[model samples]
Each structure stands twice: as structure tokens, then as C-alpha cells.
Target: MTAEPNFVLDLTLALGTSAMGGYIAHRLKQPALLGYLLTGLIIGPFGFGLQTDVEQIQALAEVGIAFLLFALGVEFSLTELKRVRAIALQGSVLQIGLTTLLVASVSLLSGSAQTPLQGIFLGLVLSLSSTAVVLKTLTERGETSTVHGQVMLGLLIAQDLALGLMLALLPVLNQPDAVGLALGLALLKILGFLAGAIALGRWVVPRLIQHIAATESSELFLLTVVALCLGVAWVTSKLGLSIAMGAFVAGLMISEIDYADQALGKILPLRDTFACLFFASIGMLIDPTLILNNLSTILELVALIMVGKALVILPIVLGFGYSLNTAVKTSFGLNQIGEFSFVLALGGLEMGLITEQRYTLLLGTIAISLMLTPLWIALAPRVVDGLHRLPMLKDILNRAEEPKLLSVPSDLSDHVIVAGYGRVGEVLVNVLLSRGYSVLVVDNSETAVQRLRNRHVPLVPIPFVYGDADNELVLEKTRLETAKALAITLPDPATTRLVLQRALAKAPHLDIIARSHTNEEIDVLTQLGAREVVQPEFEAALELGSHLLNTLGEPPFDIQAVLTRIRDDRYRTIRPVAQVGEA
Candidate 1:
């Protein structure tokens, strides 16, 4: 007997293929998103014809978008949202307005749109930048806590909110007379939903999390968090909003609570899985024939999106009083068209505002733009640096404002510079302070800086410098040249290396103690000019050996001598030696 087609088999094949594609992309040092999209392009009906059940895969892909939005919401904190609120709100509005006008004008001039409605729709589609790509790159580069990073995140948050409004308006754009009334009603409904969610978040959600936590059941806690995410998503759909909108609201609700991190941890796996599918499904929609035929059009639109958006955004960021370095970086980071553009394209297709061919063009442009984001970000800093070297541009580039240089006593000198304020740094600070040594603490975490500021310790002089130690400006602000010693305790190996190089360049004579995770890292850090490198593993091993020796009634003097010898040999005696031929 012949078997019927099975959707389960197709689903497994799609996911499995996406995994291989993602792995390949990772190996190439490219974003897994590119691989996921390529997977869809290959296995989709247009290529190998593996995923014949496209509709089912697309349905599951919707879940991926919801989870992506939900995770974004969880990461969105009120403090960060508020920090750049003015710039985020105003800059988003300005960027959207300017981009729409520019693109709509171009669309009209180029005959891309048959009607004003279509032109407006097309313009809005190009206005947004991809939050997923920008955030992922920023986090990977460890720039999420930097000045430009904050600005980029703030603008993305603003754009996400703007996207919801655009989605609300798209359905009614075809109705000229009913447009205002429909928008008003929609806004009212959204505001009402938000108010209710805020009330619930302020009371019910936190209590629910508390009760769930009290159960001491991690499974129950995770289950409840998922329920809350889906429940809100359903409620939003019922209220005539997108599921993505609901998921974002759900995230905002959980973000304000003590369990925000826990909720994020629980939802991340599902979010990532679904997000991969979402990106891959986007890939599935690409028509290879259409792209080959419209290569010129695709290239033209990609140039417009990559170049036009950056030109528009650079001035907006500059006008916000940000340094040119930050402005250029922010603009470059946002040069790509976003995933939300696909949503708008779909809505436009549903409303008959755009043809299938145009939709194909939009998808191709967005995919190409996203593919270029990482490269653009990598080159942005160097580009800005080059521009600053030009005689005329140098003055203009440096003219923009820098982070407020905090005040320290003029006589502050001979202090120890602590490069991180995490657990290890904190302990070191306490020990240094108790000995009457002045400590200059530098950290990139805003929360840590704020906490240190608010801490009420009368007569204690802990000068906290709020910036990334990796930045030369931030390092210079610490007056490392005058410091007696430097401690590098940052968790990231690359960042530690960067800070070490920068610090040693400025103060070659500074006594530097560094932390390493492995024997290789210990050697590498010492070679980088660290006066002493402490590997946690060998230290733990020594402690354990000392304890064992004491239990065996070995002499205390002998134990001290053994530990001292191990330290003198740089943990050589305790570490297993590699075979001479081993790599």
C-alpha cells in the first residue's frame, strides 16, 4: 500500500537540514541565520523539493516570530528603555518619517508603485532595521554595554514599537475614509491592553512567579512562564492585534519582575529554535528564477537599503549629540532592512497593494541586506577612524559630545585600577580598601556602576569609572599611567587580552595581575606582559592538595613549601604535561 504524505516527516527534515546549514555557517564564521535561510532556499519546493508541505512549515514559523519577540521583550529593561527614551522615541519617529518620505518620493519617481498607498507601504517596509541581526552582532562583539550599543538598542526598541503601529495601520490603509477612525480605535484598544497588562504585571505576574518559585519546582516555574507568554499572545490576537505584539507585551510584563532572568532562561531554547525556523521559512519563499530575472532590481534596492538608510540615520544620530564614532557605528549597525519588513510585505500582498513579483523583490533585498550586516558592523569602526584621520573630517568627527567625564580628586594617585566589578573584583576591592588602598574601579555594566554609586559608605573612597575597560578613552580616564597596579578579572578572554594590551601600552611598568581559565590561557596572558597570572584550576588543585596533606598529618611547613614551589613553577608541577609531539 502507498503511504500518504506525512507532515511530521517534512518537519523533521526541515529542522534537521536547518541544523546542518547552521553548523556549516558557524564553521565559516558567518551568522547561522544566513545558513538557516540558505537551508530553506535549498530544501524548499523551489530547490530540492523536500518541504512539500510549505503551509505547515510556515505556520510553525509564525511561532518562531512570536518567540523571538517574546525573548526580545524579556531582554528589554525599563532602565535601558528609559536611558535613551528621548533619543529612541524622537529619533525613531524622525528616522521613520524621513525614510518614508525619501523612499516614497523615489518610488513615485521610479514608477515602483502604482498608487500613493503602495508607495507609502513600500516606504514603511524599508524604514525598519533588523533588531535580531544587530543585537546578535552587538552581543557577539561585546559591544552591548558600550555607548553606541546602548543607542542602537534604544533605537531598535523604538522601531519595534513603531512596527506595531505600522502593523495596526496597514489593514486600514486601503480604506481612506475609515483610516483615522480605525487607527484611533486600534490605538485605544492597544493602550487599554497595555494598561491591563501593566496592572497584571504589577500584581499578578510577580505573585504567580513567587508562588511558582516557592514550589521549588523548576519545571512548574518554566511551565507557568510559558503559559503566561502564550496566554498573553492569545489575548492580543483576540483583541485584533498580531501574536508578535502580544508576545512582546508578555515579555514587557515579565521584564519588570525579579524573575525576569529566570523567565528568559526558561524561554530561550524555544525562542532560538523557533527563530531559526522563522528565518529559514523566509528563505523558503525566495524564487530563484525571479531573483535571476530581477538581479538589477534586487541590487538596486539592496544598495538603497544599505546606503540610503545609513545616510539618513548618520545625521539623525549626530543631531542627537552623539560622537561621530558612535553615530557612524549606530547608523552602520542599522543599515539592513528588518525581518518585520516581511510582515509588512505579507500584509501588503493580502491587501492587493503589492504584486507577487514586488514581494519577491522585497524578500531578496531584505535577505541580502541582513547578510551584509555583520560585515558592515566590522568595517564601521575602521571607516569612522579613517574619516577622523582626514584633516577636514577630523574636527567634525571629534566635535560631537563624549560620555560625561566623571570627576575625581586631582590628588588621586598611586591607586590600584580594578578592571571589573564582578564577584572577583568585588572581593579584591574590599581587601584593597580595608588596607587603606584607594581603588579605581572600571566596569562596563551600567547596573554595576549604578549600584556602586547608590551604595552608602561614609568615609570610603571607591572611585567607580563607568565604561568598558577595552576602550582607550575609558582606560585613559582611569589614569592608568599613575596607578600602582592593575587587576584584570573580566571573564571574556578576548576582552581581557584587549584590556591588557591597552593597559600595558599606557603603563608598561604597572604591576599587572591577571586571571586565566586554563593552562594555555595562563601562558598567553603572561606572555602579554602580565606580572603574575593565576589559573583557577591549579589554585583549586593546590588547595585540595594542601587539605589532603593536612588530613594525612603532614608538617605545616612542608605543605607551605609544596604550595610555594607549585606557585614558583607557574603551576607546572600540578598541570599534566603534554606529549612532546601533541598539538
Candidate 2:
């Protein structure tokens, strides 16, 4: 092996381009992957080609996909799938098949460079927007448990499995025998690979990780975890399967481990960097000029991608016993192009199943489709409402709807507000509700609020207003005058301050419990009139400590519950300091 270079230019370009993409994407409410794709587009063969070190950079970028999907596999579980089986399988299959038929037909008619079979591949790809991107967006916004989000995750998982299968099929699609043989071999390899990985995870990796954790070298721990994933992936690839399968299996194997969350947290930042690179690489594949010249194709493709797919999916979801509106929204969510399309296209090219022109067309189409998902999702309600009123869709809408009668009891007293509804604050809500305390939920979540509203659950069921909790008006609407106290259950300190300030002014006597994202937030929230502070990772750490102590045969056996009790901590008395300035 050669010695490592003092400075890697390609690495520099990857980092630089990724940073640029990330910053820009952050500003645009888009995924960094989009930026990465743009980076690749800017510096790709068409753009700068800047070939001083293209090969090494491309290789580095590819690892982003592996690491990203590996982590993604951990996020998904068969258990979760079973829990959401109704949406995951039914919604996904409906979305994929419908999107495929519509997109393929339109592509063939629109004179796309791709063949009909390639169009099918393109549609399948289009149906799979990046789960990594969407999930991160949802998580950051604290909407994972939201109905549409859950539906989105279910559909994404289906797409992921499809992408994996596409990987198996793409490299052998032209050869019928190879297709059957390779796919069969791939399936068997994946199954065995998963079994082997689980065995290692259940019996070997945990002990190894425990030993490594004891060493307390984070660098070492991260390296070891990375090694495990890469090692397993390599073994699978060597066994005649795609490395992508190995990556996903690696994540699944460790998903159930005791330190799985910790392991994931440590690797997450690094995973994001490479993931951005992966998206940039995808962007590099697009030809902006070609896209500009192909406006008609793009328009037709986008319409087919969204309209035809939605038409097919809405009916299927309705058939499966969901209401038309819910089905329509669900269909809208799946109407984007995914990262899988790029992978599939590459696979086709490698297998001589597709031409370069067709691959480019697919890439551009997928990119355009993906670019539209957030916008589309944002506009779903209006579109669904309009569609419901349509003469054609109205009957379908009436046939089976998700359920209506938002009995929003208008008679609720103002109460303290908590933004996030995660586990940490669920207990708080329970305590408040059980004690006959009327608390107004200031959550922006569409589904959670909808659930609480549907049940007419506490305080005569006031509507749970939907929007960013950090906004001043969201707090204002919560009726701080009637509010007895306020709680900022969100982890972000800056956001906490926005809520805390409004609370102090509106109801000075209000007892506020604010969540902290950092240690500094403890001091900051104290200054901001937060009567108490909660940190997500801090809570998790306490749990881990208790878990560790019990595992080591400590005297007390009730470690977990004991850790959950915050009575010992001066959480109530922790007066928030000024939102800014020094201690």
C-alpha cells in the first residue's frame, strides 16, 4: 500500500463543494444531497470536470451512499414496519406501481431517450426520494410521529427495499439468465449476510463495543464501529452481492444493540459529511443545458411523475380502506425522484442495459422530481382539497376518507405550552393532565395535534395550532394570559428563548420548563425565565449511566426508573438567566 498524501485535493474539493452545498441547501430548505448533486453537476464532466483528482473524489463520494444507507437501515426495523404495516407495504406498493406505469408510459410517448424498460426503472427511481434526506428534515423539525411523516417513512422504506432489489437487478437486466441468477444469488447472499451480521451483533459486536467503550477513546470507538460496517459489507460483496446490501445489513445488525443509539450518534456527523458528498456527486451527473433545452420533456415528465402516480396511488390507498384525502396526501408524498434512480441508472449502464443518453435523461428526471417533493408536500392539502372537489375525484374522495369531524372544542382555558411531544415530555403532559392542569399544546405537528384534537382530549379540546413553535405568534395564539405556565420541551436553546421570552412577558408568574440543546443552554435558559431545563442527550446519558451501573452488578437494581426521576435534580428551581450574556 502506498503512503497517504499530505494533502488530498480531491478530498479538499469534496469538502469544499459539500460545505457550499450544505450552506446553500440549508438556506433553501433543501437537502445537502441536492447540494452535493449540484456540486457534482458543477464540477462534473460537463462542468469544471476539474479532473485534477476526479477518480479519488468519486470513490470517496460513493462511500457516502454506503455509510448513509447503513445508518438508514438502523433507523428502520422489521418491528417498526410491522407496526406500520398497513401504510408501509400497501401504500408503498401502490405508490411504486402507479408511479412506474404512469411515468414509463409518458416517457415513451414524450420521446425520452430511455426505452420503455428504462422508463420503468426511471419511474421506480422517481418514486424513491432520499429517505435520509426526508427523515433528517422531519427529525430536525420534530415531525417523525406525525401521520403524514409516518406514512412517508413507510413509503420510503418500501422504496429502499426496492432500491436494494434494483441494485441486484440493474447489473444484469439485459441478460435474462443473468437477471434471474444474479437476483436469486443476491437474495440468498443478503439473507445469509443478515443472519451472519445479527449473530455477530448479538454475540460479538456488543462485547467488542463494551470493551472499546471502556477504553473511552471516542476516535477508537468510531473507528471500530466503521470497521464493523465496512468489514461486513466487504464480506457480503466478496460473497457476490452488492456492497449496498452489506451496508444496510450492517446497520440492521446493530440496530438492537444496547449502545446502538450511542454508536449511531458518534457516527452521525461523519455520516452526514459523506452523505452530502454523495448527493453532490449525483448533482454532478446532471446537464443543466440539456435540462434547459428539454423543457417540454421536463414538464411532461414532472406531470406524469406527480399526476399519474397520484391518480394510481390515491385509488389503491382508498381500496386498502383509507380515506381519499389521506390517500391523496400519501400519494403526493411518494411523487418525488429518489437517489435510488441514480444508482439504478448506473447499474443499467454497467450492465449495458441502458445508453448514456438514457441514463442522463433518467438522472435529470429523477433530480427534477426529487427537487419538487418538499414543495409538493407543502402544497398537498390544497391540492387534495381541490382534487376532492373535482367532479372526477369527488366520488373517489367520498368512497373512503381518512375520517373527519375535527370536533375542536372551542372552550379551553389558556395553559402552559410544551412544544415537542417526545418521550421526555410525555410524562410531563401525563402529570399535568392527571393533576387536572389544563395545558395548551403549542406543537406545529399536523398529526399529533390532529390526534389530540380528534379525541377532544383535555381542556375542552382547543385546536393545537400548527406552525414553528419558535415563532412569537405561535406562543401568542396559545393565550399566555390564560396560561398558568409554559414549558419549552424542544431541545434547541435559541428556540427555547423565543418561547421563554413570550412566557415571561405574557404571564410572569408562569412556571416554564425549557429544554436545552447544550450545557450552555442551561445557563442561557435560566436567564430566559425558564423555570426548569431539560436536555435530550443529558437525559439519555443518565439512562446510560444507570444501565451501566446495573450491568456491573451495582447494589440497586431499579436503575432505569431511578434515572427517569428528575425529582433529585433541581429542575423546578433552576431559574433561567438572561437569554444571552455571560454567567
Candidate 3:
């Protein structure tokens, strides 16, 4: 008897292997996508050849890309982008243009491209960095809200926005005479699509989502959201643009609606599931033998791409007035070729702009680069610290706009030094100022420092230092020896730890209050000499629990006692710890 096709079995194998891989990656403290990719490499045709339905898996992977971009659109924040608009908008443009010019020039000089158009196509392909990988890595490191993180994300957003134009302009690159017309037409198409999307978001989508919510059937709500996402993607594909771009546009439309959070919550599971297939499919394309044979060449290309891209990006960020630390991290985070480069490479191959061999080489280089991104980012802090330690590099790296200070006493002693000017720092400063405490703020963000300068505190002038508090020089400027206390409220844990260590090294007897993002961090910070470590979430939970007990007629004295015990123990009772052999 003939057997029917087993797409379900194929799906099961793919997802099962992906989950195992992801779990292993998590245990190793690496990005889970690396695990998914390795899984694909093992089971793909070029490896053990366990899966027969590779094409079907790839088709599903397209949905993964759509959902990935869709979720990005939903989470996209205009306010965050606005904060780094100068670098995000202008720096991205400069980066793309410079990278393309440099790559094309090198290709021509090396005789790698037979024609200028081919060289330019190669440049465009290499210019884009992987937004998916970088964003995932940043989120994992808990650096999404930091200055460098915001800058990297802002530049990435600009790149994604430019992707629509790249998709349109790539097809006509061979026809040099028609390049201008193609660009103009592409711009018009993008503008038209955006205008229509804005109109719909402002009028149609909200009403439709509201109506869907009224039904109170979650399945219906999800289906409608998916339909809108894919429907828009389909339209963009028909318009000779990418479905990914269309999906992002659709997400942006939903983001403006009141139900954005609800839509995001409902779609996250599907996005994650499909996104696994997408990353795995990329792994499936790796021909292990090809890489083994061309190992030396691929390694050379990988180093060239990463280092060259970093060189191109570093100055762009610094020239935009960002700190060296910010620039270095941003450069490291975005030096790799993006996944979308694969799409562009395929288009170039179809148009005969590059050979099949060149296409394969580019694919291998991109995959390796993407795999290295997380590890590279993890090492960036060390690189920055090393640079700072060098005598010659120290001055240039720390060179930034002079600190803008407000009214300050000549003898700024017995004052509190706040290490961050973010949400936590702002509140702490206000409280200290209102209570007539002298305050000095240290922050790296120019925008945050400007906000401090613009503060109308009546008679209380907000004196501040505009630099990374983690740096010894910046911390020294805070007058740690004479400060009453140090409040470490930096969002990045590494930076927070560094600031705490440096502060104590300068003033061993200073009362220090530190903020911790995780339970594990509370223990680490406390052990590092922080007099008190506060986990905001745990504090919020304790407050809520106390209210609940009060409403239940429990004595306030007893509630306080219970809270004091938990606090005194550094939250050991509530902190979750992995048991032996848990993994």
C-alpha cells in the first residue's frame, strides 16, 4: 500500500529538534537561535539527511519571517526612536552609503565583480545588519533600555525602513539608465503604501479591533490579527515588494490602536513558534562540505565583514556625538551581515549580478557572522574597558562634550551622587532635592543630561556630569570621597556593577543603595558591598501583598514584620533557584 505524505511528522521533528537545541543553548548561556540553527545543520540534507520535506519547511519559514517583522512593528516605539533620531536617521543613511561605496570599491579593485552594477549589488547586500539577531541578543542581555541599546535599535529601525527601498531598487540595478526612474517609482510606492496604512490605522483598524474585542472570543481576535498581518504582506508581495516589509507596516498600524498590547500578547506565541522555523531553515541551507572545503576563505570573509563593518560604523556613531562606549557597543552589535542580505543575494543571483558560487559563499559568511554576534556582544564590555585602560586611547575614548552643569556650590560636599538619570534616578533626585539634600547626577545620555539641565526646580539647581558612570574618570568627577551616598540606578546590570565597584573603591564607607533587575543580582550586588539592593518588582509585589493582607483584616504590625524578615534575608525565600540536574 502507498503511504500518504507525513507533513505533520516533518513538523514534529522540526519543532522537537528546535526545542532541544534551544534548551541546550539556554543552558550554555547563548542565544537560542544558535541552537535552532545547529539543529537544522545536523538534520538537513547536507548533514544526516533526516528530513525529506525541506521545501515545505522553508515555505512555513516564510510565515516565520512575516510574524517576526509583524511583532517588531507592534513593539516599535516612536518615542524611543525619537530620542536617537539624529543618529538613527542620519547616521544610518551615512552608514549604508559608506558601506556600499567601500564594498563596491573593494570589489572593483579585487576584480571580484565583472561590472559596476554587480559591485554595487554586492555592496548593498553586505551593508545591512541582522535586526532579528541583534534585537534578540540585546533583549537577552537586558540592554534594551540602555543608551547604546537605544542607539543600536534606532539605527536598525532606520535600516529596516530602508529595506523597502532596497527591495525595490535592487531589481533594476543592472539597468543603469533606469536607476533613477526605478528609485523614484519605488519611493512613490512606499509613500503611497505608508499613506494608506496611516489612514487605515487612524480610522478603520481601531474600530475593527474594538468590534472584535467586544465578542470576547480570543480565538476570533487572534485570527483577525493574523489575517490583517498576512493580508497586508500578501498585498506588498503583489506590489513587487517584500512580505516582511508589509508585515511590519501592518504591525505599525496596529501599534497605534488601543488594543496593541492585547494583539501583541495574543500573537507572541505564534511569532516565536514560526520564528524558530525561520532560523532553522537558514541553518538547513548550510552545506557542511562546502564550508569545510572553503574554511579558510570563509573565515577570511567573516573577519573582513565584521571588522570592516565595525570600522565603518564606529566613527559614524562617534561623529554623531555619542560616547566611545556607546559607539563601540553599537559597532560590535551591528557589524555582521543581516538575514535580509540573503534575500538580496538571491535577487542578485536571479538577475545574474552574482554567480551561484558567490551566492553560496555569501550565505555561509552571513550564517557564521550571525552565530558570532551574541558572543561578540558579550565581549564588548571587556573591549571597551581595555580601550579605556590604554593611556593613548583613554583620552580620545573619554573625550566628549564638556559636562553641562547648573548652579552648584563651590564646595559640593555632603551631597548624594546619583549614577543614572533614567526613571529610577529621576525619581530619586526629585525626592532628595525636595528634602533639601544636595544632589549631583552622572549619566551618559546627552538627552537625559539635557533634561536635567532644563529642570525648573525653583531654587534647587540640578548639577550633573555628562559621561558614563562606569568609567573611573567619570566616577572621579562625581566627588565620591565627599559624597554622602551613591545611588546606582543604571539599567544595564554590568554597568551597574561596575559603577558600584568603582564607587566603593573610591569611598569604602559611603552608604550605597543599588537597583537589581533580577533576584540573582540582589545577592551579587549585596555581596559586592552595596548596603542595600532593591529589586523593584519584588518591592512592588510586597506592597501589593501588604495591601491584600490589610484588606483581609491582618494587623499592620504583623504585615510589616513579615516584610522585614523577607527583606532582611535578601529575598532568599522567594527567589527561584535551579535544583541539581534540573536541565
Candidate 4:
């Protein structure tokens, strides 16, 4: 029998170590993933050997990939992906081509006995990086909607596709005939898988999820979703495809289903908890001792691959008539190898297509490149700015307005100010905007900022000067002096009172409206200088209580629409508090 006590001990230690690492990384303002990777490095066989059950952990890690890809596929539809086909496909292809050429040239110069096929495999490995790493970094920084974020996500999608193909065709290419047949067969196989999944998910899965959700137990919902992910994984593997490929296919099939969304929501609570284990486990596979002994060669390959790959990607994007900003941003994003690299390296090792040494080098190099991406992106603005200053290249970037010091009066009569673009603020902004009053918004959510920017809303473009509304800086941005009225739509009563106090001191004559969820809170804010205190629940109850007196069949209080209306405001805060500043 398996050692149950050992299993329990291992899990407890893994969870504790991983949690500590995540907390530490969260405090450091870096991706929690890096902390998990570091944790694995410390606890792996090389360090504490706490994860003694390597086989079991590997199996779980494999399951995590299947589930993760399934979720990605569910979210990434073909239609949405097609919009950025230019950036994703061409960029990924270029990244691969130039990276391979550079790596092969370096290998040959270094006197490695690697042949053409080995060179191609090595090139493939060098071209890929840590998907989990780069994506987490992008996500943590709140850059997903930026032009660079979209391009980065698209290329990652393409990388996933390329990885699927490599997983399919690489092993089969051991023979020349198999090489010719592999592409067609793999394509046909993928098509069949896609067709079958679409039919099953649309027709059959919704009924199953509704039945599960009807029970209203969150645990059952989560369990059923995991089963679906793993069941699809097992089914796909039986068809001679990778489990991840199956997971992705299953994800795409369920993209349009209502049950899919519900089931997925339940499946993804603390997803990265297990997913971090997946990344950290991969890092554990790397024996840093071997990496240390060959530090010179590793550093040389790292520089060669990064610089050479960037050179290859630069001209291609520039040739596409992307402004220097777009071109440079595109290059910086692709400069790092990512998730696909790990997939390709491990697959190559499994197929015996690459030697163990090459595999280690490839993994270590990709890891380093991924770790460097955040710094690269952080420094990109200055680099692009410097490049933009050149006349020949200057005309390429999209024009953005140069910000000027907006001098408005410190206090005003009958003016408007919105705080926190939440549900109530959304409706208030729309109603106020329809009246054509000059509306000033203060919020810290980056997502909200991008959304408002996309709509070209007539509001001050800067993020909230301070994270907390209680701060003097944020109140200053709202120009307490220039406003005739200020509406505090944020949920927190303490914050509303704090803003009211600041407003009274700064713009004593301004009318203040504070939104509160409870009557007691509203009473407190009114005492603090708020001219009016509106409770959303009470407002809804009043409206419904009125409509109930007349329409007879009006739908019960629509909490969702009320919430949506609140979001429709100019500051309808797209910038969530979770994803704070610039990515």
C-alpha cells in the first residue's frame, strides 16, 4: 500500500511552502509565480526533497495543464482570436524563425555535434519561453487590454497552437514518410476532435451542468467541472493527442454555453493555487547544479537567443508599418521565450530527439528569459520613447496628446464629481452625462481607465492620484475647489465620510452626495457634511415598491441591470482595485 502519512505530510508541506512563497511575492510587488518557482527550487530533490512523490506530483501537474488549457480554450474563441491574426500568427512565426537561426549558428560556433534535425529541435526549444510566467506577469501588471497586451496574448495563443502541432508531429517524424504524413494526419485529427467536442458540448453538456447547478452546492459544481476537464483529457489522450490539446479542444467547445461559464467559475476558484505548483514543479525538474557548472555556456546562449530573436522580430513588425512604438513593444513582448518552450523541451526529451544537456540548457535559458520579461516591459516606455525621438522612426508611433497642467478653479458652484465607477456611479455618470454637465471622475482601476479611453469619454484621463479616496492627492485631482457637487458612489462609508471631510475643508460650499448600503452608514455620512445620502438597496426597493403599485408584472428588482447601469458611467470603473497601476 502507498504511504498515506507520507502523502499527508508532503501535501501539508507543499501547501505551506507555496503559500508562504506566494505571500512573500505578493508583498514584493512581483508575480507570485516567481515565488512558487523559487519555492520549488528550494524544496525539490536538490534542496529539501520535500516533494518526494515526484511521480504523483508530475501526474497532478499534467492534470493541471489539461484543466488550465481547457479554461483558456473556453475563453479564447476563434472569432476574438481572428481580430488580431496579423500580430499573433506573423509575430510568432517570425519569433520562431529568427530565434532558431541564431541558436543554431551559436551552437555550430560552439563546436556542438548537433545536426540539422537537432538544430531545428533546439531552435524550436530556444524560440519558446514560459507561458505561465509571462502571462502571470502580464496579468499582475494590468496590461492585458493595452495594444502590447493584446499582441502578447495573441502570440501566446499562436504559441499554444504551434506547441500542439509539435506535440503531434515531432515523435512521428522519426521516419521520412511519417514526416510528410504527420502534418495532414495531425490536422485531420484536430479537426475531428474539434467537431466532436463542439457537437457534444453544445447538445449534451449544458443539460448536465444545469442539473448539477440546480443542486446549488458549490462543491458539486466544482467537482463536476474537474471531472469534465479530466474526462475530456482522458478521452483526447486515447485519440493519440496530448492531454493539453484535448483540454484546449474541450475548452473551445464549451465557449458558448451558459453552463460552461457557471461550471468554469466554480472550477477556477484559487486556480493558480494548484497552477503555481505546476510551474514550480517544472522548475524543480531543473537541477541548478548542472546549470551552475555550465554557467558560461548558459549565459552565452541566453544573450544570443534573446538579442538574435529580437533582431529577427524587429524588421518583420516594422515592415508591417507598425509605428515604432507598436514595433518595439511587439519585439519586447516576443523577445522572451515562454510556455511553449517548456512543452517542446519536455516533449523532445520524451521522444529522445534532444540530448539531456540540450534539454537542460533550453529549459534554463527560457526560464531566465521569462524572468527578464517584466523588467524588459518596465523599461520599454523609455526605450520606445528614445526610438520615437528619431525623425526617421518618429513618424511611426500613434499620436497621443501631450498632457498639460489643467488649471481649473479650486472650488465651484453647481459642478459635478464622481467617485469610484461602481454600479451606482455608472448610472449617475450616464444620467449626468445625458444632461451634458462637465463630469470629473476619480478612480484607481486600470481596466476602467482603458475602457473609458477606448470610448473616448470626456473625463480627466489620469488614474486616481492616490489609491485611497481618503488621501489628499485624490481629492486634489477632483478639484474640490472647482466642483459645485460631488457624489461619493464608493461602497465604503468610512471613505465617503473621509471624502466629505476633505471636501468641506477644500470646497466648503460644494454639495456632497454619499452612497451607502445601510441607513446607519448614510446617517453617519450626512453628519459628516454629505448633503444627501442615497442607499442603493433602498432606492431599488423604493423604485420596485412604486412599480409594484402599478405595472403588476414588472420583473423583480434587477440587481444585475442596476449593477450594469452603474458601470455604464464614464468612470464606470474598468480599473478594478485588484489590478492597480500601470502594467
Each candidate: what lDDT?
0.80, 0.65, 0.85, 0.65
Q: If the candidates were sorted by their lDDT against the true structure, best first, what order would they fall in? A: 3, 1, 4, 2
Winner of 3 and 4 under TM-score: 3
User: lDDT, candidate 2, residue 324?
Assistant: 41
Better of 1 and 2 by TM-score: 1
Better of 2 and 4 by lDDT: 4
TM-score of each: 0.81, 0.66, 0.92, 0.66
Residues 1-583 of candidate 1: C-alpha lDDT, one tens digit per residue:
6544578788888889999999998778677777888899899878788887888888888777677767777876666567677789899999999999888899988899888888889889999988767776775565665567778878887787677678778878977887888778777887898899989988888888899998989999988988888889888777766677688778888897888998899889988887778778878877787778889989988987789999999999879766666788899999899877888889899899899878888888887888788889878867865785689866654443323545456788999988888778888888988798888888765556776776644655468776666666777788888999999887655567878987999989999999785566777888899999888777888899999999999999999999998887678766776611121
Per-residue lDDT for 427-489 in model 3, tens only? 999899889898998988777877877786784568888788887777777888999999999
> Residue-pair clashes per candidate, as listed?
0, 19, 1, 21
Best by TM-score: 3
TM-score-superior candidate, 1 or 3: 3
Better of 2 and 3 by TM-score: 3
**Runs off by more than 4 Å, candidate 4:** 1-3, 74-79, 172-174, 237-242, 259-261, 314-330, 339-343, 346-353, 385-583
lDDT of 2 at 177: 74
